[model samples]
Target chain A: MLSTLQDEKQDPRVKRTRSLILNAFMEILPEKGFQSVSVQDITEKAGINRATFYAHFPDKYALLDHSISQMFRQEIEKRMLDACHYSDENLKTLIVTVCEFVSNANSHCKPSSLQFESLVEAQVKNQLQGLLQVWLEQDDSDVDAKTAATAASWAIYGLVLQWSHDKNKKKPSAEKFADQVLPLIAVNLRLAQPA
Target chain B: MLSTLQDEKQDPRVKRTRSLILNAFMEILPEKGFQSVSVQDITEKAGINRATFYAHFPDKYALLDHSISQMFRQEIEKRMLDACHYSDENLKTLIVTVCEFVSNANSHCKPSSLQFESLVEAQVKNQLQGLLQVWLEQDDSDVDAKTAATAASWAIYGLVLQWSHDKNKKKPSAEKFADQVLPLIAVNLRLAQPA
Candidate 1:
């Protein structure tokens, strides 16, 4: 699934084919949603045959997984978060990024279903855990990096999800919200002294 | 869904019927797994009519949700953690409770699918957040109770889940694991002094 992120360095034809499928999928997702958007719809929109579509993706769920992962990775890279270590500043930026990503996803996908939301949550959290694990391992924290990262990733995703769903017209902006919760999340990564 | 927990204080007949349905569902869940266990299977197992089952729960998913919520609440109540204010000791016990509950759920259910795991996750996390929010609110912390609880609940659930799935022979006991990560989780609720 992560390979999809590096597809740009793959064979040109494969890259172009995948791009077509992904672009078609993004276009149809808002119209039909993840659950209802059929592979045939993507094929038709991409101007590719069923065989070609299948060659690129096993099915629409895999396509959604790939698409979500790529999109989230771009968000992380855009802020250069993928290259940074654990810090309060970086963590705050990461939280804001997740908040905006989830908000965009909630609005972009019309009438998003629970299943679709869960899929997005799973994909985004998985990547968050991986990225956080890398960042924590580069630091001197004595806690289990994998476990800490897992906890932090889930916390970030869950908080951002709640923030996105807040119906209050006075809801804080993503940056402001991130600043408020940054300490709670940062402690997960920064706690415990080097043994 | 939480109302199911208070059914004990409701009419006796309602309590009896829910107990019967929940027990039958638990019995069939191990044998047939959540997805394959139909309402018919549960009804037959409980020796109750379809109408009786319907009168209790709208569908199996609701049954699953109610069952999980009740079970998790019982775990918290059993430890008397639900009645306590925020403290490191209480937090450690809560983390241990979650670890054991998740471990038990993973082992009790047969052929647990991703969907089943996710449903359990959602149900357990909901109850955890509610419980933690109450605990945090009773203390003098200035952090938003809802946001702090949301992040703590997800972190605890996510960490315990990782511990449960650890296939290594040296996986720490739930209590030991909880002790190790208590500070990481405690800070979420304890930080941000009262105004």
Candidate 2:
């Protein structure tokens, strides 16, 4: 996940092309969505050639993955959650952050299309796994960090997506939902309880 | 999904190589799993050079994707579910198929590793979406078939995976579990009422 962010030191032209394509993608997503936006649409909007777009992203899906990952990382860094160790308080904050991020992301996409949701799911789960891996490694746990992280990350992203989709009359607030599911999510980590 | 099966007309040598590599992969998977089985191990096991393995698969993940997709498709065909359209009976069968498949697949690996699980998730979900899309398109519905299929397929795969992971003393059998979740899965398709 960090490799996606470490491209900042690349050739200026490469960086310029990527930013242009990503900016155009963000602009077009609200109007057309992830499914309908073609490579040509992005290149045309970005004022770049189709080949230039291809050089940067294999397809719009790649662009969406990169874009969503960047935005989600930004969300994490904003909350200062990216570098933190695991704690009950931090976990609650992380869950709330994801809830708000998924909710806002869905609302911004106009139709909340499947393509959009799936892209969000992939990117969010990926970053969540990365974050959780770091947190798990910081403590002593016999459970495999990557395994625990993968399970927890997927579970958190799935639950948050479902929570964001809920429209029941008595739907719990995001905080309440997080609190309710916290134990289920925590068990995925299997932390060696600090003696 | 059909394209994966349409490779029969390809060069006999290409078919031979793929089968060899796949056979080696399956053998190693039970011993070392998806994470630890290196490209070299597969090539050496198959009695082919590393270049031969590279020519066939970009990486083990791709191999895993292909291998899992092929096996799961066979499971679908064995049950005669591949060509059928959606019905409650079919849906229930699909759910049970996934539950049993996941359960059996997990049992084959020593640790039920994350890499193994994730690859299975991707391949199964892809096939499910394709099958659901065909079923939804065969009938009229207010819901977008692609969108509904994507949503339903992911939800079904996710729920069945969780179900397979459940070892509670009171957990239902696969058939009973399918019957229980059938309604929840059906609503995602938004099927029109039968006249």
Candidate 3:
């Protein structure tokens, strides 16, 4: 769902319009949620007409997809994980990032519905798979990159989702939780190694 | 979503009614898919009234949940995997079972929508987590059983999903694929083991 103009070379006007629409959408999301926020609401908040909003996004779901993608990509870049290899330190950082992201998404959204959660999951997992495949390929592991990456991405996401939903008062911090499960997830990528 | 009467002590009449509803659902699912099939459709197909259908299930989603749970449980039991502890062989069998179930679900439903797939996913993953937790706890692993089970269940489901969707002409058989990924998944449960 990446737009061609999503890069730095895009026209200033296009970038500004997209940024305004995204900002307005994000502001309304906490108040009305992804389900209740309408196109008209977003357009009015952004000081843009319906046509301008439509030109930017086909609908709210598409907007959510784009927003989640951008947010998750930034999370990866923030830790410089997008350029990293399959080191233990990098993997632990990735897990922490995911834990923080899922936790933040849950708390930020007014009332995160199942639809919104699944949409975020789909976007995040897609990017996770891509980033993981690159890491696996770069490591020159014997295991099939695509399958291992798929399993690892899902495993990491599932664990963090569980962590985010933990109701226990003594729930561990994200870094602590990631460190506890680090070896478990690491083995999924390098199957030949002794844990 | 398991009914109180979903056991051997259940009344024969209740069992018969539930069976009829489930059978009718299984029959209509392939013809009309999950979304298009309604309570009326199930009732008519089962030669029962809407009230009788409602007596067994609250709605079509609940019916789908119960149906999937039964089917996957039966698959697990058929291999005697439910009665066993964590072993390399049993784990391989579980992965193969998931692959087969996912493949069957995709083919049985006329055009499986995202909603249907996600519903099935939630039900299957819940059961898988329960089963895996039992296995992990029985093995007395030092790792946290709850978190490890959650991760392993999602990993197995995700890998099988990717396998089911493989467009390659020479995609591996379920057994072969399971063998390939067995070590990767096994380590998720027993962190101390050497792969």
Candidate 4:
């Protein structure tokens, strides 16, 4: 399924419109920024009418949302689940998966289609908030799981945020990052350990 | 110091103006929204002159920033930091500190200081950006630690955004919340551990 996306991205028409809209998005975003992106502007740039653009996407925000959520969902969710089991090996694998996932996603989707600033809270938080809720539910009834989940979920979110912000030369290896960050997560899981 | 501060909050004149500003802030927030708050409005309600108000704060945004950051730095950081060795505990504490700080800051600052809609990347990313750069410069060079820090920081920032947009009960039980969140940090730290 993932491999199929690379093939799909090769379509010239898809590439053209998506690129045009994205270019327009970038131009508008840093200027008037996210709040100002208009459907007409995007359509005009792509040389398509409002109707044509609407057929492709419901609205400017939705198109931008889809571009980001679609690109990274598979990788992020996979990391969340892969990190579910408690073992050193599992942990190491999860770290690489996540850091690499973030790195790859940044390389592929960024400067367009995946600018984090433009994300609306409810839209972006849906999956992460849900993931945290489930994780916090295990062996926990005392604390507000949602809040805990929110904190934990966000830490990973922070990790990714931190990863993407660096203006590195050679680029930081995601594997080493996984190593540095993984230890921070281990202490919280002590509560969930088998009694 | 804490007792003196508490006493000051109880003084009649201070209490009245403070309450007035806080109340006005809440009412204006949902209606005119965050960025729209004005000096005249705040002064009118508080029954204070602009000069007097300025004595307390440089501007409305500064007041809001101080309010939120004050609540967070005092309450959340005290709990999350172990002030100990450079191990998993240190990182978890740091992560939890960040998540909780953001969570608390977002709660108070949203309608007041945290006008994400109005802020540019320069302001939002500036101080934190500098701090992350310092933390990432080390043998840990393999990781774009600064970027990772920013990403993680923003994730917490993002979570707070989600929380602000949702309906949740507000109570200042820092201990309860911190205990709840510690595990998720543990998990992430564990996952990020090096081989």
**In terms of lDDT, which candidate is strongest?**
3
Docking class of 4: acceptable
lDDT of 4 at B59: 71
Q: Give Cα distance to truth, residue B69, candidate 1, Å.
A: 1.4
Q: What is the DockQ of each candidate?
A: 0.53, 0.04, 0.45, 0.26
Q: In model 2 chain A, which range of ten residues has the least summed lDDT? A: A1-10
Best by DockQ: 1
Candidate order by decreasing TM-score: 1, 3, 2, 4
Task: Please give each candidate's TM-score.
Answer: 0.82, 0.54, 0.81, 0.47
Candidate 3 Cα outliers beyond 4 Å, as residue runs: A1-24, A35-60, A192-195, B1-24, B35-62, B192-195
Candidate 4 lDDT over residue span A1-195, tens digit each:
222235543767766666666666545554444445578776776667677676567666677666556545666665566247335555456556546655654454435332344353333345555654665566455545555445544555556545556676754677666666655543332333211
- Candidate order by DockQ, highest to lowest? 1, 3, 4, 2
- Which should have the higher DockQ, number 2 or number 4? 4
Clashing residue pairs in candidate 3 (N, C-alpha, C atoms within 3 angstroms): none
B144-183 per-residue lDDT for model 2 (tens digits): 5764575567657766776787777887899987776565
Candidate 1 docks with a DockQ of 0.53
Supply candidate 2's per-residue lDDT for A184: 54
lDDT, model 2: 0.76
Chain B only, TM-score of each candidate: 0.88, 0.90, 0.89, 0.45
**CAPRI rating of model 1:** medium
> Using alpha carbons, what is the TM-score of model 4?
0.47
Residue A81 accuracy (lDDT) in model 4:
60
